[model samples]
Target: MKIKTTEQYNRIIQGATAILLTEGLAAFSTTKVAKHIQMAQSNIYVYFKNKDDLLVSVFRYHQKKYIQFLVDRIDLSLPPTDALRNLVSTLDEFHRTNKESLDVIWSIRQSTTLRQLIPKVSDDQIFIAIFQWLKDWQHQGTVRQLPLMYLTNLVFSAIIDYFQLIDSKEMSPNELAIEEIVPPLSALLFV
Candidate 1:
């Protein structure tokens, strides 16, 4: 019941993520996650309060990792267009390289039923950093004055949606390259 190490905890999350990606959230359970990782179900219980906690944690974990990746790549001090390009490029790169993890989360967002089931968790500053940067740019009239949520979602969802199409084989892998994506995305976000 005592969660031992960070590595083990992350392994459990990654195992649950695999289940979510392959079997869908409707099929996810701590027992399946345990079996997927070849561990006792109680070990998952030790780390999480219950199924929802574990589920929320899985989403939160992946989001935090991705936000950190994006934030690290774009300098807040840069001109808005330059920063937006960096943001777009980083996101496209993430989609190309981190398909497996992105598949789990992007699918979750696509499902209204799954969205309502997962409990909301408070986010750390890392989660707020990207939004804050966008907000700062908006205040300076560099970014669009539209609702921040919509603005952010448009940029991220566009890239992920395309990648999801490719992952589902609904679209060809070569349908769109990063070069074609970034310029339009940067234009859409910055003035």
Candidate 2:
């Protein structure tokens, strides 16, 4: 029962993603995905050789989609400060809208086996692009001369912490205002 069409493949991937998000990695199985999609369990084998392969595919699909979303929002032509603001806003919005997907990604990263199985998916290309932009800004004396990795971690870690606060309902909307948040973070990274 090899997937004969793009539609079927997408359907299986969607099913897999939903299962991973809801049930988590420990309970994820091709049979569960098949049941979720209302297909025979054996049918999933046509598209993926095993549960690990299917999970890897699901991770890759979401990773590419998320990166594209971030890339679309960021404009390299903008001033470094403005570009950083846009990037932060985009990231906040992405996390707000894709909480479940982000959770799945985080879980995958935490699991050494799954993390190694899909090494390329774990590569944060959007962060790399941002690092390059920051380096350019540093050369122009617009941003502070910190290590690129340190700056990248500082910015993204703050965003991640904000998401966690929101997830736990510990932060109110007023407290999470981007205006109040992004400026200080921008100042920390920029001159």
Locate the minimum summed-lDDT window of 10 residues in model 1.
118-127
lDDT of 1: 0.73
* Highest lDDT model number: 2
TM-scores vs. true structure, each candidate:
0.75, 0.89
Flag regions of model 2 displaced more than 4 Å. Answer: 1-3, 120-122
lDDT of 2 at 89: 82
* Candidate 1 wrongly placed segments (more than 4 Å): 1-3, 110-145
- Which structure among the candidates has the greatest TM-score? 2
Writing each residue's lDDT as its tens digit, candidate 2 over 18-132 gives 8988898888888788889999887778878888888888888878778888887878668776777788788888887877668767777778788888754315888778788
- lDDT of every predicted structure (CA atoms): 0.73, 0.80
> Residue by residue across 1-53, what tens digits does model 1's lDDT show?
36388988889998989898889877788889999999899888878889878
